[model samples]
Target: MAITSANQLELLQTAEAVAREKMIEPELVIEAMEDSLARAAKSRYGAEMDIRVAIDRKNGNATFTRVRTVVDEELLENYQAEFTADQAKPYFEPQKNAQNIWLRDGAPVEDFAAGPQIGDVFQEQVPPVELGRIAAQSAKQVILQRVREAERDRQYEEFKDRAGSIINGIVKREEYGNIIVDIGRGEAILRRNEKIGRESYRPNDRIRAYVKDVRRETRGPQIFLSRTDPQFMAELFKMEVPEIYDGVIEIKAVARDPGSRAKIGVISYDNSIDPVGACVGMRGSRVQAVVGELQGEKIDIIPWSEDQATFLVNALQPAEVSKVVVDEDAPRIEVVVPEEQLSLAIGRRGQNVRLASQLTGLDIDILTEEEESRRRQAEFNARTQLFMDSLDLDEFFAQLLVAEGFTNLEEVAYIEQDELLSIDGVDEATAEELQARARDVIEAANREALENARGLGAEDSLIEFEGLTPQMVEALAKDGVKTLEDFATCADWELAGGWTTVDGQRVKDEGLLEPHGISLEEAQDMVMTARVMLGWVDPDELAAAAAADAAEDGDAAADAAPAEDGARTEEAGA
Candidate 1:
């Protein structure tokens, strides 16, 4: 192969053909050709010479050149390609009137007298190389390598933004239980675990899957598709329901026991359109479309509610809920159902409750009405026993305290006198006696806990920390945090129990002071206060940071307000 006059245009034609086949820019292919030609020229000329090739985009003419750069004496390492400033003077002699030559090279304009400034370049046209058999093969390999890289880059850029969408493709083949799908412009992998149940595919079979992820790997752009994702079901609804696609109704949440059962919570922006009815469609047509795609997976379309209890009740469909007890601090809920509805609420193998948990983003505990009553009775008896032993009261008096919602000695000891007096048969003197007994018991327990903490080598500094109770101090000491310094060094999550994700499940990490009713926010405040007291943190700096954070939050809220108001105004105008 040679860069002859008759064949010059052939180079550009080949580049365009390759670029079109690879779906990349033609300029990229031309640049790769230039690199391969330059390498071959270097092999033919002196190997040390700096050779470069450029192809004219308009006429497809090839220009070969040798370049040498003027550099500082100490930095000039390649003798053939770089020259020291002194050796480059001849190249600059003809351009003596070039304005501010010294200044352009970082010297003062007033000192504009120039020999050859460092970084000045010299170039001369060179004869094009005649490629022999081995040289042609080497150039071909270089061009192929560059073209493959450009193709990969183009593919990555094309698919990166397409993730989280649904795509249709033809099944190419199966490799190691993974289905290879030809997605027109690129190939995608549908991993075995991402398939719904025992779904199988053969070559040339058409498949629709969620674009779960798009990653740029060393080999190529990897597109991962999934059929078992909950978002897959949500997207299917969006496709089938016109209201969803038009944003009249929004899918609030979706939970799927892929191939078995799924639940989708939806809400409508327009009150006229019922989200559930719109999703279910006339005669269940729209829902049936989604269900058919999901391999007959049963779907429960429920109307989403801001009230969690109401939403949970709706999520557990065809079952009667007697009551819902929500513990906001624990972020868990208890649902009490009728005895007959217990099995339905739980579903087969607890699938109903599990999907409901996923949909609500909360852990759920289901119990029968009879079981709830038993648990309540047991709690009442425990509180009654506590009052009887701690206050030296009769069982009837204890029962009265429990009935009045007095659960602990702390409330009995610290509550307003009027509250205790409001109880039937309780006079001022009786109320005073009851409070005195409660306070005595509380004080004794605190003193015992403090003594134990001191025995465990707890420092006076730790014992005197304002936020920690005696029981909290004792718990910290038991956990080897016996000093104020140790307390300050602890993480907020270590001082207050938090949930951690382990093996794809959220597990609870119990904290030392958790049993003492310490919240994460309270723990953070106490630890920061301790650091400030120990002169480890500046209170002024902390206040400044907090102020900046609040300002940012205010700005974000302000930005959101107008958009919401505009939506409301539009609705009103309509």
Candidate 2:
């Protein structure tokens, strides 16, 4: 326990081992030891005394000395604030009333002797104070502290450049629900806000994150890592997809509903490569790895197209598409699909189309097959009438739509009253009238449908098909569909089949087309005229029927297509 000098060598070896482990030089430790001794000397000696300490670097040993100032004749006057020459007389009795008294050689030998007065001198013969065990222990602590400071500086230098760069880390601890990651050099703070919603980490778990920021605080530099930032996803792609990293493919835009689905728009500058395929990799292994990192979140990597309709179609994935009509000025798209596919195109809760619209930066409206068909028919009818009117009288009615680049009534229906007024020669009143006319057409169609439903439940007297009469036909001729071709083209019989009361009950066809509007005689004449014009009823039959019609003047042939016979074989043979 007390092997003295031999034990000191062992302690020196232990100190040297710690210094090497902490990357601190032994010379700094020795300097720290000397500094501690000087501080100790200052506390032991009075403030008027001077002290200094020096260490031998080779031996790890410390030495100290005490110093006194060599006083001159100037100290006799104003240096002492508390004790003036007169006031200090009791302390120095012989100089009671003498202001200019200089100490005579060997006048008095006392503790208050000033400097080397009366020929005093320093003796360089004094040996160094032998440091006791307690001073040695204090020196060890100071040395260790200096070593820690040096190591901290080294650590800071190593990691400073790594700031703002992603790194793999292990979960070291979780304090107050905040996870601390050990990223080799130092700990990084992963705040709750920086965490992805679908991910969770436990102690010792390995995770990757973006180094968002690094701050030099008092204790040390703080590394801030984020997993939720959109840049993190971009960076992840850059790391995983070789094409993007190589700059062959570029990511245009990224929109995400994080932890559920994300949409990324990408394009390739090179014609040989496909951007989407590159991101997806062979059999989707590339994106699958990324999705696994994001905890099974779905990623839709769509090809970025210059055409907005094409891009929007890709954005709304898994939806069967029929057609897309986009108006760039209005920034809207009308999506058309089969009637049964409407629900799919719109998606569950409309999320598919909604996200697509967001990704493509366009407003989308979905339409069913029937609605699209009606629209096409209305457009055709409008175009044909305009052409016929302009051709017959040189009124340029067709040019009205053509000049505006509109070929259809559907386009007119979409034009607002204000927009219509902006067109040349369209006054506000005229625009309003045109809008009213368009609306009336829609309303009349709806009312006809309603009246047809009503007649299905009640007697046909309240819901007569007035155009069945000759007088009514003349009136309806002004509304177009004047000829048999026009009437057949619109599938009038389909409308006839649905005629019913509003309550949806069937009504008796009691010659109702007559009393409520046109009479029976006129209805029969109109049917005969339609049959003759359509070439369905022969001229001889029409003549005979007219003779018979004049006697009885009742109903005529019902409108129906002939049954399909062996026409399929005949057409195939032809």
Candidate 3:
């Protein structure tokens, strides 16, 4: 009996010790203690009995009890859980009544209700005894399981919001090329692919990595970390450089080649503060610290400019840039470097140019000064010859047109007469003649294209549709979309995307429409117009159907305009 009482006290003391070890609240541990004890009691008692255990939080005192509830003999439906056959046996005879607690005359018996009132809880103290070995093991298992669950929940809550921040941990071990770090409260995994290629770590070595994700799994919360991520290097700079931390200098963008090289584009908000000098610190002390942490990765700090061309030149550092021709529409840049600097601009294996593209967010094509000059000459000759052939102009007149930025017949035909006449070597008579010839050639070309497309079995409805270019109609015919009905039945993706498959399976039919350089909404509008022309749907009906579909798909905001021209064209996302 003394041993049994000592075991009861040990239960509460064990819970407190486990709670402190697991860094959980003592209250949670006590709850575990009660649950484990109750499980052991249930094993000793019958499975159907109401057995419960409660541990006092203030002391180690425990209460073991068998719980029952009071019930009204007159009301059987509400007292099902608490009512038992033995309690009602007193009222039942050899043949039980409809209400088991009622007398044979169908009247309720009042004898059983005086002891315990209806809807009252009744608990009976249980005697102390030695729990069987199996039941004791069962209690320990329950306590461990509950404690583990609570610990997992706490760890998840602790690291959920720490993603994207830099974290420090000690390298505990490595398995299958992945490093496992022992963070203060939990473990983090840095996969082999996330580590810098030129670096290595030994056991107990401290390291810093970016927290990429914290995912809850069946076993526990997995903290995925990365060291080669561009954001990781950027965060390191944010820590080493005070200007960036205080928001005086903004790190516009970062591109890294892991331990080999990296580039950072920075911009200053204040006119007096120089972003590069501040990041470099006094005598390059700040940047050196960052570089040392990165395993001697070369760092290039470039000043960011709103003018993308200027920024690109700055990003391609250690290489001189002579000229930059920007195509804003294509979002590409043609950079011309001196012959002596071509190899430097391109770098060894194109690393320099690659990083420049990432930093500026533009496609860069590097060209030598000589190659650029030759390309410019070729463009000039091509434009000059085009004008001479289309308008029957002499080389002198074509040269003037090309120099004035008139590259096409449409420009020459639609340009204001005054603007054309104001050109250096052009007079009003010459401009009028150029405009007449341009208009005549354009009309002739349109007639020929329509005739060609019609002969290819294109419907007059499609030929007359102004939205599609002549080439578009020709391409449609080759794809078996000649008639208006064929055009109306085409799906939006067939005309917009060339291919998008699912799980290595083709989602689109073979030989279907391919991308014609338009968005899906544009393709949809084309189909709608064909339907309206074929008399399959009235314009207003087509508009209503499109709006209804858009609203149903939760895309009404993109097509909010009334679908007067068939359905309103859906714009590409910003």
Candidate 4:
């Protein structure tokens, strides 16, 4: 048999073993022992039989006891008193019921129930014994679970704020094709897709990424991260550009063809400060920082303009613009570049112009000098035909008859048949044939001329001159703006804003003329046509000679009217 103190020391050693093996606290062993002993005693004796058990955490010492009631004749009935009523005969009853004491039944039984039988056993001291391995293991598991629960709560508090923030981490280890990054406070998952193209990773390599998500999984906290998102660029720039952070400059939009190039639109509230310059920073330091973050991808910081043409021209930077022909109705623009600059303007694989078009919200039609010229020629030919068709004569026959000394079709058609016959080529048969042909041509020409004078519906007032290409004509038509007269009537600055095509193609701006196929001379010609059609000019004084011509016509009309009046008066007088 183990002595009390020796058994206590052995219990302490067992608790320490359990604590180390299960990684649980030693104090829990003493607590479990005390609880088990108290429960055992309660099962062996009724719950009403008072019992107690205690265990010392330091020594693992345990004690168990039973509390007994002291009773006499009066006390046996109450189970709490020590005196009998016979000791105070006058004060209480000491009859038959008194010797019978309280029994389980409410009525007194025949059997004697004095406070206690001399042979009744009241309490027993149960000693601690070795617990089964499974019981010890189960207790250890419960303690460890509690410890882990506390540890998880601590970790969650540490990492939740870091979600969605950009972080730099060292590659810790990789598992199941996913890489784990040590983000100081916790581990973050670097998904395979988030790895930059052509970028390799190894243990201990430093990497930068945006925290995409943080979630609590069964094992622990999980953090998801990414590197390729465009917002990553925006966030980096905001860190670099003070104006953006201060809200003085706004980044309106960002677009990227990642790993290659990116375009950002910016606007500033203050007109004095350029938004592009502010974003670019001093000597390009601010933008360069963002570029470094992106691994050398080109960044174009374009100043956002209300005019689509101007915006596009800016978006296609490094390539000079000769002109911007805007078509507002169709949201398109044609960018004209000189023949030599065409390749530069279009860029490799046409990516430059294509991205520019997308960035500026315009359908860009890039035109070369030859294409522009052909386009202009076609437009001129159409207008010339329309103009000629409106004249009251068969255009070919009118020229022919005019060469033959008949100035107008009316004069040719009105000639006498005999007079026509008198001419060298005019036999009676030829004369009749020529005269008949003249009348038919005249009627057809007249009808066409009338139709030409009237135009096609409400878009009529805008007379697009024959000389301008469809690009130019379409641009002017969209402004509710008409001919050069209408265009020039407004100040040059007014037309400087953008315009679009009916089908949404952008007309190239005039500034692009040299770079496009048009020379300075052609630009001037188009500008002149634009100016003349719009009727813009410095105010010139009306000539004093205008009064003399009016006076002369007035006198001639007066003299003619009086002569007719005098003839009528003479007839009345007669």
Best by lDDT: 1
TM per prediction: 0.89, 0.43, 0.71, 0.41
How many pairs of residues collide in model 2?
15
lDDT of 4 by residue, 1-574 (tens): 2225356777678767765654556665555555555555554554555556766666666766653333344335423222243432232222343221332224432443343332222333444443445545554565456545444555666677777668889998877657899987567898877765656678999988887877887787878987766667777778898888897777766666556777777777766667777777777788888887777778877777655666777777767778877744332478888888888788778777876766765568888877887986675555445324544434553344444555344565688777656555447876666666667776775455334433322134344455444334344444444445554454332343334466645554433212223344444445555564455532232234557778999997875311100000000000
Please provide, for model 1 over 342-390, each residue's C-alpha lDDT reduced to its tens digit, 9 standing for 90 to 100: 9989999989888888998888989998999999999999999999998
Candidate 2, residues 204-299, lDDT tens digits: the string is 999998888777665767778887665666778889998898988877777665566677778777777767777877777788877877767677
lDDT, residue 446, candidate 1: 96
Q: Return the lDDT, model 4, position 69.
A: 35
- By summed lDDT, the worst window of 10 consecutive residues in model 1 runs over 564-573
Give the residue spans of candidate 1 off by over 4 A: 1-6, 45-49, 95-113, 504-506, 527-574
The 10-residue segment of model 3 with minimum total lDDT is: 565-574
Worst 10 residues of 2 by lDDT: 565-574
Residue 407's lDDT within candidate 2 is: 58
Which candidate do you rate higher for lDDT, 1 or 2?
A: 1
lDDT of the candidates, in the order given: 0.86, 0.59, 0.76, 0.59
Q: Estimate the overall C-alpha local distance difference test score of candidate 2.
A: 0.59
- The TM-score that candidate 2 achieves is 0.43
CA lDDT for candidate 3: 0.76
